[model samples]
Target: MLMLPAMARSSCERVIVSADPAYPPLHWYDGKQLRGASIVIITRILTDLGLPYELRYLGPWKRVLYAAKNGNIDVITTLKITPERRSFLIFSELVLNNPVAAFVKKDRPPPFSKWDDLIGLRGGIARGNRFGSVFDEFMDERLNVREADNLETAFNMLLANRFEYVITGYHVGQAYIASANIDDKLIALQPFLIDSQNLFGFAAQSPCIAYLPAINKQLEKLHKEGFIERALAQARADWRKTPIIGKN
Candidate 1:
């Protein structure tokens, strides 16, 4: 039902946007189509810009990153900046604030008050996903981090006592817990490890890389109009309707 603006129509050039189909509330593949807060926001921005684009649900997080790095994809709906990623991507202004937290089983919560407390404990993270520069550095040097294919897999491993905790976005963790009917069994550790600002990014070599400034400008306008907040709320409500649990 959503149509591109007449004034914003484009030629044959199309921007290929890649996103992790398993990351919900933010975005996820609903059997046949991609839908979520970021999807809606990006859709509006692209439509307003009159840009031809295709939204692809290539996932497992790692594959999405690989595609973006190789310029096989033009844009990623959301990602946090990392030094390695910076080599191949140019990021837009902040798109959303995602609070990173550690989730643990309720019966055996770890005593973690500071970053150093995480050392020695087995923790799970999505393969090829970075929490932040500092956390990633600490993880590399001190923590015993186990990699999973996706957040759900990591959470499952945590529940099976394969790991002491699983690190992921707070909202995402909570959504999965609820969806899996394990809310009473799992709890997100307080205070958060990091508050990451999610951003739109373009492959450095993509022809659409030139559109960064325009995208940022539109993102700023969307923020000012409270469009982002409204879209997020709608996304949360919609996600709750299905409450999908598993790979995505």
Candidate 2:
């Protein structure tokens, strides 16, 4: 792990971090505590740097984004970069590369060869997510998009045949399917929509913004040393042992 210079590190003490409580295997509320790969990795990084910090399980995914945007929260553990979000947050280097894919009922899979194939299909997406700049723009202008408050709701809607497909992070969708025991009923389409990098970002108006350089440096080191990979592997194992139920 890379160590920040003492002065730079000191400024980051007592930082406040927040993430969606339901995004599991990456981050989630385990009834009493916030737990997941990102949470565990980030906590270790902060501890190793001797920076005291607070982790918060804010309301929903949208609420977490709202808090981070207004500087009510210091850091957000995982988010995809977009022009709108860039207005309120300064992002760190890539923390995890999340592949975005579409889920469909096994009986009625769509002909999904490329991005353009999704244009006319009815699809569900989480309310505040941005798959990538290209897909976001496409959704805005062309796709038949339906927004849901969370992934579980979106998946439920898809299962009920309310929509033809639901787009989500590949691993997250897989975990949700296994947890909900819907793998036999649904399938993820081939050729991901995009590979999005999950990042740690500070609110633009945050006091912790000054420490972003140091944070990025440490994050890069962690990524290089396989700390993040190890944490993710462990989290995947844990998720398999006890799959998480999707919130209704």
Candidate 3:
């Protein structure tokens, strides 16, 4: 683990946490509040640390990030570490591996075996989504990908032929396919675009930043104990029982 810089203790009353409501099995909005493995893990860590925390349902994924950028939210339970995100947040230890994939219409799966194959294609991705710094830079400089407000809309547009593909988390795409009963319509291409790590991020300007080192230590303990695996399995089952509401 990398050592974090020393910082003054926080006078923060409670940690405010939020995540993409549209992302599932990891974290998602269940209409009323956030749910899934990320929530289960982070809240448990806070409790163990004897810290008060609030899991705010701040609408869309983009808004949740905006709140974090402005220090309105102290922690984001799960997100890939990207260069732009690092500007406003300090990330914790690796929480889990999040593999990103390109979803194409079943009948038109691209001849994609490498990143270079995607250059001329039109792709769709949800707003505030990032695969990694490399792919993000590639997308900006070489690919033609558009952003939709959320995954549901991006998938819908893909189905409507508005775009050739939609790039998102492989598991998230699968969950959406099952929930929407569109299993026959879309498929995630093999050889994932990128496999990224999901980590808890504390806002750089939030008083909660003081707890990052402690949080990282706890996260390391959880990973070694395999608690995160159990939580994810439980979260997947819970997600199936709840209805997935579309975000605006």
Candidate 4:
């Protein structure tokens, strides 16, 4: 493991990004620069592949999706592809399968046991996040879905009862509930149905696909080296020790 020097920072070819300060374990702002699990994984993959690139770090998820869709960005890390999006982007092999579910205040009756159940309920979800094309397409128009600026805010809204529920990753749900000192008020219920999801290397076409295969290659390497499990376990441990501050 070598540290990148000042001369190394400007070396890569441009890889488009929109990693604002919101997403965690995937992307984050360290009060100085963008860094996180996805960034670490992406950096290791690109560096190992000898691919030089720059990150755009767009502030909104919608913008990130738009950039990837329009060829404004070469690739977006940790995106799940669905049938509807396949027409616009190519995906690398699965980086990860994130579990998704409805997070609600504690002691509440289960409002969801199926995708169709969420359709009639008013809920919040981060814009551009998808469960699957079928679910995403339905979410696009059928549900009374409110768009939150980010996952934490969505959890905030849920706690405030601004919405009936919030659709998001189980990790995010757990983190937010713990971080906000709201575990007593919120609980993730019935994973209901599981989506065989993948955080794909989203590319506009072949040239970019050339770069993405390297990420899968590195992921395979990391898997064999036990890096993935250890990193995730570390993240969970760190998150658990960090206490909730204001919302207590």
* Top candidate by TM-score: 3
lDDT (Cα, tens digit) per residue for candidate 4, span 1-248: 75332223332355554443455555555444555556666666777877776766665667666656665566666666677568767776666556777887786645666777776677998756678766667777788988887777887888787888898877656765665678788887686445545565454542546566667888889778877656655555555564322110
lDDT, residue 149, model 2 = 82
Compared with the true structure, what per-residue lDDT tens digits does model 3 show for residues 1-248?
84222123356778888988878889988777788899999998999999999888888777788888877778898999888899988988898888999999999888989988889988999988888899899989999999998888999999999999999998788888877889999999989989878999888888777778888899889989999999988887777777466443
Q: Pick the candidate with the highest lDDT.
A: 3
RMSD (CA, angstroms), candidate 1: 5.0
**All candidates: TM-score:** 0.89, 0.89, 0.90, 0.77
The TM-score, computed over Cα atoms with residue i paired to residue i, of candidate 4 is 0.77
Where does candidate 1 clash, by residue pair? 8-50
Candidate 4 clash pair list: 12-52, 12-53, 13-52, 13-53, 17-57, 18-57, 18-58, 106-185
Alpha-carbon lDDT, every model: 0.82, 0.80, 0.86, 0.64
Put down candidate 1 lDDT per residue, 168-223, tens digits, no spaces: 88767777777678989999898888988889878877777677788899999999
Across 173-207, the per-residue lDDT of candidate 2 in tens digits comes to 88788778888999999988887788887877776
What's the residue-level lDDT of 51 in candidate 1?
94
Query: What's the CA RMSD for each of the models?
Result: 5.0, 5.3, 5.1, 6.1
Estimate the overall C-alpha local distance difference test score of candidate 2. Answer: 0.80
lDDT of 3: 0.86
